[model samples]
Target: MSDIFNQVDNSIYSNAMTFLRVPLVMDPIAAEADIAVLGLPFDIATSGRSGARMGPTAIRQASINLAWEGKHFPWKFNLLKKSKVIDAGDLVYSTGDAAEFTQKVEKAATQLLASGKTLVSLGGDHFVTLPLLRAHHQKFGEMALIHFDAHTDTYDNGSAYDHGTMFYHAPNEGLIDPQKSVQIGIRTVFNEANHGFNVIDAPQANDMSVEQISTLIKEKVQGMPVYVTFDIDCLDPAFAPGTGTPVCGGLSTDKILKILRTLTDINIVGMDVVEVAPAYDNSEITALAAATIALELMHLWTVQNKQV
Candidate 1:
């Protein structure tokens, strides 16, 4: 009808103002935001694999195609869209010192939390979650964790800030309470015999069904503020082959989504997705999975906050 509306391609371009269409800010204005995503690209010290340092960029590139369905998201419940989420880029890390890197991550996370915004973190490794959680605990204190992974990640502080020890190390730091924490999709083989951390593995419980695990998560995290962390290696390599440490017998992408979706009632204060190494991914499937989970977490946060 009008030249301004001339032959638009809705199939390729839906909305210009959606989150995916905006320019990714390296240093976004922190104070006036609803949700802030900061990347921590320092997985160099990871004992499992070192490629996770590239995870943030891969997830960012994969997120460019994210769409806004407004209220009717086909993947999950129609989450309210009142939330404002933005990428705040990666924090600087020291290659030499683990403690220094942890401090830097804590600083960035603290700044974002002070803004009263939810932190959707793109991680360097699972170890980065420790620093992020350290900041959240500073403000909230003793939040429950909904950890998704193949291994327990509770290895005693072996040497330094590596991927295998964040869960164990956090509790020792009083950042996470092991009794209140809930871990899902935990497969064996990476246990005490394999030099892994000591965590209560729910997937090993009776019948090991998604419903069973979901119920356990609900029961464990009830009435407690929650932090949800997703490790790409948590999924079987068939679904997420790009992680630095690809583990077998892990949860499927669909299974992980189902568990997270059912936990919508918990107060999800912060979130992180890590260990996605694009270098090993031939089909870009791992990045896609990570990006999709990020959007799902955003939806859950938005719905809970009534932002949609």
Candidate 2:
């Protein structure tokens, strides 16, 4: 049955489930692919809703809707053909244990990075990026961050496991250089006096053209290895209502795509799409948006690697 399916194009509803129908390899270190997709399916750190733990499954299922397209539009080449990508399934850990989850994620990510493969993770919440960042920092010292979210995730008042304080921990741990990092689509109130990251709030981002925004991002992270983390709440609630903490004023799906398309020249080393909670979603729009964004990130990676 598997061999027969391999001989034909997978229908949108058929075949083994993976991101963009990519092969599934459980062991990341042993996977012989240039890109490895890992799912972080734990969301205990959210201060609002709890369903983002299901984000990986929803995003992968929604990605099948995009698999039918041989070549994603606005780009001239086929992504899978240009790059060897595989879904490494989800990271397993003790249920509801945040410490175990973080340790496992960092260890797995570290192993994957050491084995010479780039990682694109699917998050349970924004906090997942913290562990991934730790792994990336070990591999590529002091990288710049390109963050997309309505909240800055830089609060100093939250607990160690809070999703709202990853950035606060990131900078203090030296995982990312705040001066070189750029946070886009932030609409929440944060302490500007001590916020070292170059922030382009929602209103500011909306006023600027995609060219201007992309240029600013490139300028901020130009000379450093970059890691991009996108939270679904970065989009306006109308565009992505399936997130735990949806903000009213946020960037549109189209605008975010345009900005990502313009960032092909940067040294992006790793990336993740987080905070997609399908329970609040209408017609799977949020998951689809995330899937599309993840696909665009892959294209961007391909461009940086000169695969296209």
Against the true structure, whose TM-score is highest? Answer: 2
Question: Lowest summed-lDDT stretch of 10 residues in model 2?
Answer: 1-10
For residues 22-97, could you state the per-residue lDDT of candidate 2 as single tens digits?
A: 8888776987888999999988999998899999999999999998888999899998888989999999999889
Query: Relative to the unseen true structure, what is the C-alpha lDDT of residue 102 in candidate 1, on a scale of 0 to 100?
Result: 84
Q: Give candidate 1's error at residue 219 in angstroms.
A: 0.8
lDDT for residue 82 in candidate 1, whole number 0-100: 62
- The digit string of per-residue lDDT tens for model 1 on 187-220 reads 7545455432224353463236667777777777
Instruction: Please give the lDDT score at residue 190 for candidate 1.
Output: 53
**Residue 33 miss distance in model 1 (angstroms):** 1.3
